[model samples]
Target: MYETEDIAVVILNWNGQDLLEIFLPSVLKYSGDAKIYVADNASTDKSVDFVRSYFPSVHVIQNSENGGYAKGYNDALQKVTEPLLCLLNSDIEVTNNWLNPIIDVFNADENTAIIQPKILDYKQKTHFEYAGAAGGFIDKYGYPYCRGRIFNAIEEDNSQYNDIKDIFWASGACLFIRNSVFKKLKGFDVSYFAHMEEIDLCWRAFNSNYTTKYVGTSTVYHIGGATLKNSSPKKTYLNFRNSLFTLVKNTDSNLFIRTIIRMLLDGIAGIRFVLQFKPQHFVAILKAHGSLYLNLGRLIKERKLLPNRSNYYNTNSIVWSYFIKKRRKF
Candidate 1:
């Protein structure tokens, strides 16, 4: 077991006053010895003042303008001095003993750089929330799938993924990472303003030879879509755009080719959106690819600095093992 006193919990709040009221109390009650920091992204609702007034001990950082999600946390993380840092969304509530298990995993294994808790919905207790359902996995095609989420499919938690295991990525909704390792990786890539930024960070950890894990013993409740409001046009754009950038920035040549092939297949899936008159989905896909091509020169320069450039894994192997034979219900 880990000592809880060494952990610092950091939350980024936009215009979520209602969520802040519900979320802060549970965090204060359950997080033993964890200092709380609320980074307000220029919320017009007076969220910073509210937090400061109600929770005097909590540190509140008020930005001048609305910085996107990744940048908001990046700013707050700079001030965190604890051994472990918990990056949580404002729309989450922790249950009993939620913090210790994740801290224990980090304490137990020095190699474990990032750890995430099992997250459930606040109202529907048995259902897995959309943000990060029981940790995330990536297929060889660079497509990311969560234990309870496949593409657009989100399943109920059902205690099916309660066992602890190494994961490809942890949800930014409630991710825990060692401060030292976070510093080593330099935190989230700012190019990705919000969506898929965590995946990019985790991919970097994988390439850096560190492990990311899902610790099932810890549990929290999430009011999913608080930030993006599911399927919003801007959200869809960021998800597609950043995922494409993540593939380009991180993948080695062999996997890069495979990822491109799979992306082409996934792009074909967008044809149905066009046929059905869902112009936003089609536009999101095209814009993502278009942005990538537009920045091809910059991406090439970024790819050159990756440390393990030659250790690319096979996309076919990932597809057959994780997506096909496993039939793991995403």
Candidate 2:
């Protein structure tokens, strides 16, 4: 069985001293004997100093430059020797007794390499968060959705998904994985920089015949978009760009057909945004496609390196399902 000390709660920070001040206490109070780390991404503020001054017991790994999420964690986690790594976000407030269920699941299944807890919104408390509501799932066209959330629709908690289950990807907000598995996957692709890197890593694990799971019994409240707001055009750009990067790198077969369909749908969404007067978001999509084209050769090279498995996705198109069929809640 995995002990509490085996888990490292590593939070990536970047100019978020206020977030650490508010949320770090609850983590210390509830995290049992697990090692807590503040992986500061070279924040210019007093975030590093404050953690050292106040929460001295919390270890600090000072990264040279802000490598965003993917490279920040990649650099910081190299110093951690623990068996389990919990890549907790700086903006999340973890609940009491969150580690026990995760440890139980880890000891129960060796093949389960990654685990994500049920993420609720810190603001609403009763509603599921947008980033990761329950477990996460993806469609054939690389669209991601969750049990309690699909697109912008969020579901209220009613003890419906409070059970251990398999999932496609775990949210980066509070993701857990075996250290060995993480190293085997070589951590998140630094190319992602931010947004959907976890899904790419999870897809890599899935391709390598490893499992990702959702332990709903363990819970955390995430203040979604604390660093990057969901409505920001930059967020739109990264989500769109990184998603194409993920799909190209991990899809099972028919790369050309799948990518063409995905891009066509993205075009439709861009047109919709234009109709809605959200021109910036439309431009973000265009920029996203442009990035994909520039990186396509690299993605193809990377894709050839990983193992491909059939039946990795369930739904054909989450866009058609959520927008046309109006199936809001999963």
Candidate 3:
């Protein structure tokens, strides 16, 4: 049984009954004594009832509306009293003793404010998942990638990254963060709604001198893109737009230069999408930029309040390195 009273595994839910039916059992079976709660985002279906009926031991926190992931967790987590908050996704399946190693890490270091478990793919099994892979890092221009994933390239889990290490960001798919730190940072930016909000939170934590880490001994399988398919135009828009917002709000230096260069790179991405006959994706990038332009003033004002860390990034240009250099495997 898990010994920690400080940790709570809170899975944010929308209309995900099928996902709960398939994945919830694994979490229940493997999570041991850690308190499990499903924070429902006003799911219209019987997801909350299903949890109540089938998994009565699992607590359910219901919100009044579907506020997406950012506000969904922000609202539900306010009710959780645990010191450590594991913000898990409903589409993830936990392995045996996954919580212990992570809990051990948290117990060891008070400075380690956030941690992400090594995430493998539920479908592929041998491959690392796209969401968080081994650990997450960002380019100098704020494009986030993982140790086992660069862009669309996902590497096989050959135990290459099987060690505890500091990471720039923790994947929200299975993020473990100190509750006090989470609240201190004001949870996630609700304006994000979803997508890249986790990165923004991690960057903020870094600015506040807290560390994010990846504990490789703890592993979970993620069935990513369940709620919003990667192919969806809306998904494309949110990702691109939220990424821009993250860059603007968190970067400590060269804000204008980096933003301009990033926009140019995004334009190149849009052109590539158009050349590939995916005009919808191109248009999605355009819409993302339009949204970013409208919200630039507020984002700039928010930057003034944040402590900008210049050494936050691990690489120069992930776009150039991934595409131009042909460096796919991480």
Candidate 4:
């Protein structure tokens, strides 16, 4: 059993009344003694009122405006004083006793700053989810992938990745982290607005000599792309732009060369998107590169202020491996 009243499970919401209605019950039912909170992002709907009336036991904090995911959490977490912070997504459904396993791991390891449970798809329970399947890892060029997922290929759950292990990054979909560490990092980079902010936070933690782990004993079902549909061009824009921001801010001394190569590779990806009759995605890549170019000087100054971590990537080039060698399975 885990310690009572030490965990604060904070869900960041933004106009997701239906999602909160359907999924919040499982979280309340299985979360046990951990305090649950709904941090609304200035949603115009009656979501806050609904929570106040039906689930008054759950705490509610309203932000002044919709600051997306990164800033929304940064603003709300200031009011929470729990030792352990679980940054849960509003679209996820928790299983029975899911928090105990993660809490046990945290209690066992003093160096573990962040932990992510096994995330499976809510639609297809047999397959791993795309946001974060088992755990997260990055390649030489700063591309993120998971243990049970690589690009578009997702592995089935046969208990192959049941053993807990140190991972490069953890998914933000259902992440557990020490409250101290979250404050130390000053939360996520608000400039990121939405995507890849979690990976950036995990990379910073690694540089600070902290460990991120995957606890396979615990699990949750996530409705991937519920907030921003995967097919939306705006989603593509945010992902591409934010990934470039993460690379520039966190990459070591070889930032110039790496950024150049990454942009070239991105060009090739844009061509591939065009070949697939997705010109909107192609334009998204171009816009991402343009934004990166415009923010180059500012990002360089930001890099100078941080401690460099050269040992960031697990593989040299996940792009080459997946595309050329056809190494789809991880």
Candidate 5:
């Protein structure tokens, strides 16, 4: 029961006409007084016009070019003046009092900067979506894992993760944060474009002494990868490239070195795909590394801005825990 009508819900749309039609109606139904903004990323499919025609009350910003995920949301965020800001995907459908609990969590804690809701797959209902499940966590080497997803293992959302806990990062799919904190952090890094930009932002928040939490009370159903399915080459490229970029920008020198070693080992894991003549995996890896090399100067410049100068996790500990020892998936 936040008295102030201060939440701004920002959804980024790019060729998501079908999802917009289904998701927007439910959002407007459940979200009481939150202002809504749909940022269209230059979709040739006329998604902008469709949203305007159907949802006249929703503010629509039509971009001339596809600015990717982070940039598209950044564009919309600029217009947001509300104290609370929610960066939701256009593919999400809300049920119950989904927005209120998140607002309550932030209201309860003055230091809490960002919070995420429990996310389930819209069609499956029981299973967690690949985008985010309970909440996201980070390994010692800066690799991100979540309660419901571990290296692509999406679990059933069985209310097992109902307890609230501090998290390393919240999924960008349905994230909420204080507008002032968002502005201080300067929003999402445009260099990331998409994929892992939220994790990078969370890492910065942690460095700046702000806490992020997972509020299981609030929930939403997500149509995972409506924008970035595995079959799409461009999506594959962004995931790989941005994952690497986030690691480089956030981790200190020692952790960065360990990440490089872990990446080499991970590359070996894809050898089977290469052997099976699956060229996309190899192409994704090649393009990712190639892009990193080309953007070395930019990455270095970004790295200098991180608050901490020394690696927090010990190298030997990470190697013994994550590397060297392999556990079987039962």
Candidate 6:
């Protein structure tokens, strides 16, 4: 059985000294014997030095460069020897006794490869966070929505989701994963860089016959958009590009038909942005499509080598359900 000491709480940092100073204490105080690590992405700021000087007990692994989330974790995780890897974000505030439930779940289910605890909003404590509210699920078109969050409609927590359940993807903000499973799956695709890479990883895990779960008893509060704000067009770009990349590489059935439907739906979103006077996001969608076209050849090649990816979606179309029919709550 997995124990507390077998876990490694590795926080991915890129010039976020302020966030580390604020949130690192709770992780250190309550983690028991689980090793805490600050995986720095070659920060020019004092992130590594500060963690080294002040939080001397916390191990620091300096990556060669700021490879965003995907490669930063890939590079740093090479040095981490723990059986269980907790990919905690710098902006997450983990609570007391968070590790035990995750360990218990891992020990109970041998096939479970990934786990995400209930992520509440750090700013609004009563509400579920947008990133991974009570775990994540994807639509047939590769759009991801959560149990407590679908599109922009986030649900208020009243002990409604405080139960263990199976999930499609666990949030990267605070994710628990088996190190052996991660190694066998070959880690996150570096092409994604950031945004939805965890979903891609989880999708691959699902295809490999491994389970991903959500244990709501273990919870953490995440300061959503701390690194990349929702307002930024870059976030829009990555979300669109990486999502398409993931859809092509992992999803089963007719890739050509699914991609066409997704792009057409995205066109509607771009028009909506135009009507809303957010032209940058519209352009971001177009650029995202262009990148998809450019890399489609390589993506298809990658998919050909992989095994059968069957029954990946929970819903046929989340866009129709959320925007058209207004089934906001998931």
**Candidate 4 global Cα RMSD:** 1.1
Residue pairs whose backbone atoms clash in candidate 3: 252-308
- Write out the backbone clash pairs for model 6: none
* Per-residue accuracy of model 3 over 208-312 as CA lDDT, tens digit each: 999999999999999999999998888999999999999999996799899999999999999999999999999999999999999999998999998888999
Off by over 4 Å in 4: none
- Tell me model 2's lDDT, rounded to 2 decimals: 0.95
> All candidates' lDDT scores?
0.81, 0.95, 0.93, 0.92, 0.79, 0.94
Tens digit per residue, CA lDDT, model 2, 69-184: 99999999999999999999999999899999999999999999999999999999999999989989999999999999999999999989999999999999999999999998
Best model per lDDT: 2
Clashes of each: 0, 0, 1, 0, 0, 0
Which segments of candidate 6 are over 4 A away from where they belong? none
Query: What are the per-residue Cα lDDT tens digits for candidate 4 across 1-330?
Result: 248479999999988899999999999999899999999999999999999999989999999999999999999999999999999999999999898888899889899999999999999988889998999999878899999999999999989888799998999899899999999999999988998999999998998899999999998999999989988878888888989998999988898898889888889999998999999999998999889889989988888887878989989989999999998788
Number of clashes found in candidate 1 = 0
User: What local lDDT score does residue 227 receive in model 4, on the 0 to 100 scale?
Assistant: 89
Which of 4 and 5 is ahead in TM-score? Answer: 4
RMSD of each: 2.5, 0.6, 1.3, 1.1, 2.8, 0.7
Candidate 6 lDDT, 30-97, residue by residue in tens: 99999999999999999988999999999999898999999999999999999999999999898999
**Model 5 stretches astray by more than 4 angstroms:** 1-4, 309-330
